[model samples]
Target: MLKTAAGGSFIIEDTTEVMTPDQLTDEQRMIADTTRDFIQGEVLPHDEQIEKLDYELTVDLIRKAGELGLLGADVPEQYNGLELDKVSSTLINEKLAKASSFALSVGAHVGIGTLPIVYFGTEEQKQRYLPDLAIGTKIAAYCLTEPSSGSDAQGAKANAVLSDDKSYYTLSGTKQFITNAGFADVFIVYAKVEGEHFSTFIVEREMEGVSIGPEEKKMGIKGSSTCPLILEDVKVPAENLLWEVGKGHLIAFNILNIGRFKLAAGSVGAAKETIELSAEYANERTQFGRPISSFPLVAKKLAEMNVKTYLLESMVYRTAGLMDEAMREMDNSKPDAGVVAAKAIAEYAIECSINKVFSSETLDSIADEGVQIHGGYGYIQEYKIERIYRDSRINRIFEGTNEINRLLIPGTLLKRAMKGQLPLMEKAQALQSELLSMVPGRKIEGTLEQEEHLIAMAKKMFLMAGGQAVQKYQMKLEQEQEILSHLADMMIQIYAIEGAFARTKQLIEKRGEDKATIAIAMTEIAVHEAFEKIEAWAKDILATMETGDMLRTQLSILKKLGRRTPVNLIAKKRHIAEKVAYASKYVV
Candidate 1:
């Protein structure tokens, strides 16, 4: 029954089989290696030039990537693409992160900019655009964020009106912070049709009245072009409309679902790079008559960086695997595979949001630690960590602010539960009665069994808190932003811990317990850390929602459910750090 539930149903379902790093196919590895080699050979050497806003060099690099078929993982083979699974696409993004700001350019072009057409375009539109865009002959940019609207994307005031002859639509608007706008040849612009119907249109740079403003300076990712798109009476043919009229939100939001997941993958890649940089710096930099890595504080930072990176990597691939599975179930004989895949990715909106928030934050922490490990040198632009830290901050702001994403995590779950897409209500009801008569504590057995138990209890805690909130507010639960945020935190922790736990369990099963020591330690560390947060958030939410005897009863249940023997993370972290320091890379 749980297996039949939709995406983000992992909160209730048993751990579904996932594709871990160890499970990458030979072909996938080849693709990853190609991407890595491309970055090292073509992009890294130009990092300095890229930082100087050399658009020509950046475009050349993108064209080189396209020549290698790196830009078309999500595009159909008929359109000169590899038509690879979501895993391959994720791998490409992850590897590209090594290029920093250039990665933003490629990600924008392939992900949000191009995916709209891949998923929502008509045959003629695809024929006209996909080949060139897929092969990097024509670059693409997504235009959804306007001068006046961002998080409230539907509030865009861009206007598109049909011509008297009905041959074209006259569009007028300014799209702000448009990635790749300076060099992009095609723009997937969102506007209101007849000044009322929100819709999407494919506008070209060559079109009359279409121009780009001067590039804006930014804190990071300067290599990627960011300019305001100016559209003044630009004539877009009616045939260029994407999806259905008034369904622009579908194109905007669904594409963003994939964008969020891809952003997570990119974050993982960036975080891993930061860890390697920090580890190497610690190994080379001397302090107190020894390498700084020999110092406990420095080692601890390295260990935390490695642990968070591993956790994020696990979740990013897990979500990608789930989307791939869903995509695989669709009938390829139909012409709607793109639409099906978009829907599949959209189904896991909560997971995507969680991955986006967690991975971005994790990367930021790793980047910050990387700088700290570099000492005073980190504050200078000469250090790579400084750029990484600056680049990492925007991930949380874009792809939906972490705050908006936090609200959506719980908000979307409730919507799905009410729609019977996720049997959350049924589980919540069952958990209610179970909690009422539940025993105080239960013994867990075997390797990582305690963590497994904690994960299950975390889910129960979420159900309990969410059910109470729903019961109290009924239809008005959206008003309680604070409670919703707490619930989101609980769900995020549950997903992260369980993702790590499941991946480690699978690894142990394949390689035996002795060989998975680092994984086991990492899993334990992540679960315990997440469980602590979940406990604090649960108490805060319950305290605000319930009082006196009721609060006491709920708190008692939470304590019993969340109870666990403390983990000696210092020892585990030391072990993890030792391994990473020796390898000078993220081993686990």
Candidate 2:
């Protein structure tokens, strides 16, 4: 869905042609600098106090962020917002990671909280609520989670019955773990009207029978509010019905797509912060009469962390670029602007889920290693990495659980194939024929040729594994959760590898190979690791799905596709660690 305007080419067709962080415009760079400066000068100073569950301080900072237009990046200028591009907001989310618990408040307010109205609200709704939301005079919270429903969103028990006079709707239900519930002035609540059709309503804090429960003790992000929103006979004006009845799922799923992408961006920022902290700590703590950073194993951990961060950051900004390009040609003046925006976001749903899973898992691994790098200090709450470690745990559960997202990946692609929107079946069929007579190896040529070839083979692996699974299970593939997850893993690796490799190729074009040495090294390392994972997953799936002669034939073809010359990863990791250890941060 994030296709380029030129012939509507998807980034997967040619990632070198897509946007990268290095391709930021002057305005984007300026906004990025402003966000960084604000985080450093204002947010960081009170980070400690902010994490103590200080609601007033959190609200005040959000208003300050509003004053700087941080909360309005996705809003239209007519609504008194900055109306920045997707990349700009991605940068804002990345920068906000440094704010710790405070980041949660701001992200919730800016993303799911406020974006519903920005995209789906009618003219009167926008005029009435947006100006205040844009400048932080009012804070909005989304109410989709119910006590009995988590991943099964459609199973919500919230019910809203229309009044006889049709003047309002009476809402009664409990929304669990609602972000910003303690202080939110407005709520984007989802309920079924007439106990049948799913829908949404805009409920106000001041309405009768509206109440906020006591904050739940949380493992992390304590500075951000987390409380249940109780709606008992709460009357919402009929005009506050969002976009019409039975279309609430549109608002819920579309907003989540955007939320997943933003979460990935924030993870990139958090990962960088972890690396910097680990590097600094490694350099200061002496062991065996030398800093711990000098050890080969510690260096290996740092390099691995840095490589994952690079891959995640590359995929994230590339996605932001895709979204911005798609948004540019839309006619927002039309009344269906909200619907148009929802469609646009839904188009890239696969990419959003990919980033969410990759970014969350990436930060989790980095955080774990971060604790190891700090030894005993990492276990203590006095250490910031400890807090980061705790905070990162929730991201996997946010937007959508990683498990649900993993299944959604291949499921979505297959749906597109059936709908004639994607040529997945055709490509897989072609790959089956190509593998029948194709030779095993290719000669390496120019810069990044190996990585590029690896990415191509990985895509073929996904197609082959997924194709065979479909042929075997057909319509029942949805029930094969393990196979689906394996297919998703391959695709996730393909996306990350292609995105990172493309960005590296772009940098090489502009700065030459010698200057892009580190980027090249990181790309190659990630590509190799990802290829191995794809290989393992393919082998497992093929073995499980086939038998006897057919299994042997499939394994033979996989061997041809997986053939490659191995590199001395140990030396490269040490080289990467040397530079990061010297700079005490992730560079390039």
Candidate 3:
């Protein structure tokens, strides 16, 4: 029997259910356990030497992962893949993150590097490329980043000129910082076509003028190949072109959105690994004649890390599950199904960006504290914390920098909010009214009244920032981006509080109202604290818009919101952490 965990249904042992092993299906659990065993037994022991770029060992491990089915989580059944859904694929990424750089290599191979063809390729292309990718018979690489086109990838300088016969595209350009460039048998190369649109082609190692430069030393993930791909008039057959002409951006953007979400899932894995490592260390390291884990400060850090990790994991799984459900409901056999689905996938750019930013920042904070908990050992090469700290830093820099993601959140939300697409603020109003009704005379402070005020301020800010993204090179979206990003974050906290309370109410109803003490208390705390924070942010925005008497009026509302809110969040978080930690992983 299969057992499911989290929100997914699966089958597992009755005893394991008590331990909260619901986050994984039986198949996923087996794969994760296998990967974990391999990492501990094979990878961790050689992690130091591998970080030095031991090519042979790295290649061998890639083969090992292939043998274990970690390399083809997304491939179809015919191509030797498990044909799993996005949630299972995310589960694989999470498992791989336990090993740091090794996970990056594996994730890139299965994610951004190879997914374009899997999602958009013709039957012939799938027949030709996916098997090798699935079995690790040949390495794969994604070529998009260039020296000048970091975030501005549309400004690709790589020229793909059509041949006189129009049967081939002569690709000429350099792709910098390409993963697996040194050994990849195939590369998904994107270049600007002569007619003004970007195009994608599968550039094989056998192709003439296809060459890789010596690997550039990276800040981290050194074991994975990273170098420049030079295609000097490399001719790729017309059949090799991915999707339609001028549609490379669609493929690139959509695939990257999926990649970003998976990256968040991977970061969640790394966070869990860091927490477990730190916990193990703290339990053994003595301080004041007792384990350091006994110290209040150290325990608090661990608790905080656990709570954030649980939060991130919950978000990742929820997003992935939603994506999987959407894909399942789509009519994939239809001629336009792929294109339609891709568009819908891109619609989640905001969700993916939010997850990416939150997960990466959370991992960075956890890894930093993981190091702190290890004392002197963390900074030294002898411990994995040193590499984790280094490897985790790149998560924020790549797959669209967090700065880019931050802007994406607010910009995406505002467009939807203004169009009456998402009723976030409206929902917030209703919740505020409900809670206030329950706690009479609470003086709700910056309630719906202030939310309306901020909405106007947001509209003006959007106008001042101009709705355009400026020139192809300028980042004029910065100011609007900051405001929107901050607003979206506040919105997320508000929604989360509402959700927590709603769940608590449901649980109380199901299990009998008397048994809902902890859940009720926690939900109350979450709502009040979130209200206070939202009010503060709303007032801050108002401050910038008005002055003197008007500012004082707005500021008073914020102070009132903060006055006498019930719920002690510190205690609630401690309880939440205790619940999650004892549940093994991702229980809350």
Identify the leading candidate in terms of lDDT. 1
Ranking by lDDT: 1, 2, 3
In candidate 2, the residue pairs with backbone N, CA or C atoms under 3 Å apart (3 or more residues apart, or in different chains) clash, namely none
Cα-based lDDT for every prediction = 0.90, 0.89, 0.69
Q: Per-prediction TM-score, please? A: 0.98, 0.98, 0.82
Error of 1 at 93 (Å): 0.5
Query: How many clashes (backbone atoms < 3 Å, residues ≥3 apart in a chain or on different chains) does model 1 have?
Result: 0
Worst 10 residues of 2 by lDDT: 5-14
Candidate 1's displacement at residue 314, Å, is 0.4
Candidate 1: stretches off by over 4 Å = 1-5, 440-442
Question: Candidate 3 — worst ten consecutive residues by lDDT sum?
Answer: 8-17
| Per-residue accuracy of model 3 over 399-488 as CA lDDT, tens digit each | 888877777666665556556766534543443344333332423443222332232233322222222222111344446554556555
Task: Tell me the number of clashing residue pairs for each predicted model.
Answer: 0, 0, 10
* lDDT against true structure, model 3: 0.69
Off by over 4 Å in 3: 1-24, 331-337, 417-479, 491-533, 556-566, 569-588
Question: What C-alpha lDDT, on a 0 to 100 scale, does residue 417 get in candidate 2?
Answer: 80
